[model samples]
Target: MFSATLRSRAASSASLQSRSLATAAAPSSSSSGEPLTHYRITLRRSAIALPMNIKGTLAALGIHRRLQTVFHRHTPDIAGKILTIKELVTVENVPESAVRTKWEQRQERKASRGYEVAGSKLGAEP
Candidate 1:
């Protein structure tokens, strides 16, 4: 019984990898034609020296390093991949418009510059 269970788990993980790749390559909306949702997956932990499979999965998810986030359209294959590396990352659903580019994310992280004064450096003296 243990062997059977192990075999099944291995087979499922293998198939999941393939399916995740396919989904990440090209995504399709449902039959209803409504826009598909997206998942913003961010790598919270590094896959360094862990295992080749885990590293590959991060690459497949478009996450290269820690705290790097990537958005992917919602799909079963992507979901499977997320599940495989769930411990190393975080996931959230967001509309397409909510997705921000790398530059945008950086800008958002930066502390806002305080209001600038047009006439500064020289104060009125009586």
Candidate 2:
């Protein structure tokens, strides 16, 4: 049991290291450094003691936890939601091109599998 905890701690540290490397390799700014087109929203604070309307505002924005990030296009509805919970989150405008889906962000954080598979025969027709 002690060994398992150590292994998990090691793995988590490795992942943190790799995530830092990924950010260092490519900066997100555009070549021209022009203004971004979409809002890069991050939940910076929790709504624990806030009113139900405030909590609902966070949910409407797709924020699930403290520090959780979600992006959205610049629209009236989104702007209103952001304004409603302006105290709880931080917002930045990022280029539409820079926005990434949850899956894409996951791929960035994932460590590459060390081994490559040449082919699989399990799905072969009989």
Candidate 3:
């Protein structure tokens, strides 16, 4: 058990080191020398209930029901669509890497909790 814990700690440290290196290596700005800003848009609600025109806008932004898409830099077209369906998309300005990592962590936590609940329910069923 001690060896297993040590191995897990080592692996976790290695992963974090690699992530930091990758982030450090990333270019800080675009070709135009402007700071590359990115936004993470998560579709919390389904836009299927909306009309075709609004749905088209959502699709154009690469957002579907319960999906998330990250856009680099703010474009007028994107901003317009976001404004049009402000209620459907939850937008946040964050580094793309950070956004992805945060979503993955959230998913992992949710999955672990779901499995724990399911396991407890099964054990009680008998």
Candidate 4:
């Protein structure tokens, strides 16, 4: 039973890695003629309310808030912090010039003239 469980866990881990690799390989566009490499540091999981010492460690590497900042390259110091918060983040690399997806940047426009957004689907037949 134990052996079967371990095998299943290993397979799950391998599948996750494969999916991550696919996301990392998504194409990105470049405008400038300069060569550059890009990386994406995604905060997969986080331990909220970090201890003071841990906060200092993260501050030392310029990361303060959770799920913030997309840096360019992988630095040793950053890698170390990542190790410290290994449970909190998942770092990946992507093209530097990659554009944000349209849906990601779409914000709900506020209603004008005192109109409020009802908590209902727009254009639903009532």
Candidate 5:
């Protein structure tokens, strides 16, 4: 049992290290060297049974559903809202280019059609 726990911890740490390295390589930024300017906030937990103000805060942040992500500029107001519900979400600093609208996010979630029909066999001359 002890060995199992150690293995899991080691695996998680290794994954964290890899993730950090990946972010370090190609930062999401423009050629002009603009710094990360947005907060990519994803709701990781639901506000069910929580206080009304907490729920209100979530709504103010435009987060209505669990696992829903919202991007907002780095403003004091947004940061305060995030801090209020810090335990319920994950925040990442992202460049402006990384922000996506609802439609774009939905489009990305769709699986691409792997095969495209070029020409019908019957339409082609044998």
Candidate 6:
């Protein structure tokens, strides 16, 4: 019984991956000279209450929290994982230059202060 279930899940994931890749490849191939090399995947929905396999797939993609974003090179394996939990996440094709590290993502999320400091308080001769 367990083997049958696993086979069905694998089949579904494979089919979904093919369909998604076909659709995704169409526009990029015709639209630009530069190819998109990375996938910007964001966890839009929580995996809570979902099947353990679904949660595991998300973990495999390096997404542990809702709204978290991770970048991965465009590959068949990654595409399969994305398709498995397609409803729980959002995917975008990005150029290699757009890929950012975890620290870079955090830095981009931070807001800049409105004013710049002319001098530090410690610089004053009291």
Q: What would the per-residue lDDT of candidate 1 be over residues 34-56, giving only the tens digit for each residue?
A: 35488888898888878898888
Judging by TM-score, tell me the better candidate of 1 and 5: 5
Kindly give the stretch of ten consecutive residues in candidate 4 with the minimal lDDT sum: 99-108
lDDT, candidate 5, 81-103, per-residue tens: 99999999988778888899999
lDDT of 4 by residue, 10-126 (tens): 977776777656544333222355344544555555556778767676566456566654453656766677678766666555545542333442432334457767588777887
Q: Give the TM-score of candidate 4.
A: 0.43
Model 3 CA deviation exceeding 4 Å by range: 1-36, 96-126
lDDT of each candidate versus the true structure: 0.79, 0.79, 0.64, 0.58, 0.86, 0.86
Worst ten in a row by lDDT for model 2? 22-31
Q: Which runs in model 5 stand beyond 4 Å of their true positions? A: 1-33, 115-126
Whole-model alpha-carbon lDDT for candidate 3: 0.64
RMSD of each: 15.0, 11.6, 13.2, 11.9, 8.6, 15.3
TM-scores of the models, in the order given: 0.58, 0.63, 0.46, 0.43, 0.68, 0.66
Off by over 4 Å in 1: 1-36, 115-126
User: Candidate 6, which segments miss by more than 4 Å at Cα?
Assistant: 1-33, 114-126
Off by over 4 Å in 2: 1-35, 115-126
Model 5 quality (TM-score): 0.68
Clashing pairs in 4: 45-88
Scored by lDDT, model 6 comes in at 0.86
Clashes of 3: 0
TM-score of 3: 0.46
Model 1 accuracy (lDDT, Cα)? 0.79
The alpha-carbon deviation from the true structure for residue 115 of candidate 4, after best TM-score superposition, in angstroms, is 21
RMSD after Cα superposition, model 1: 15.0
Best by TM-score: 5
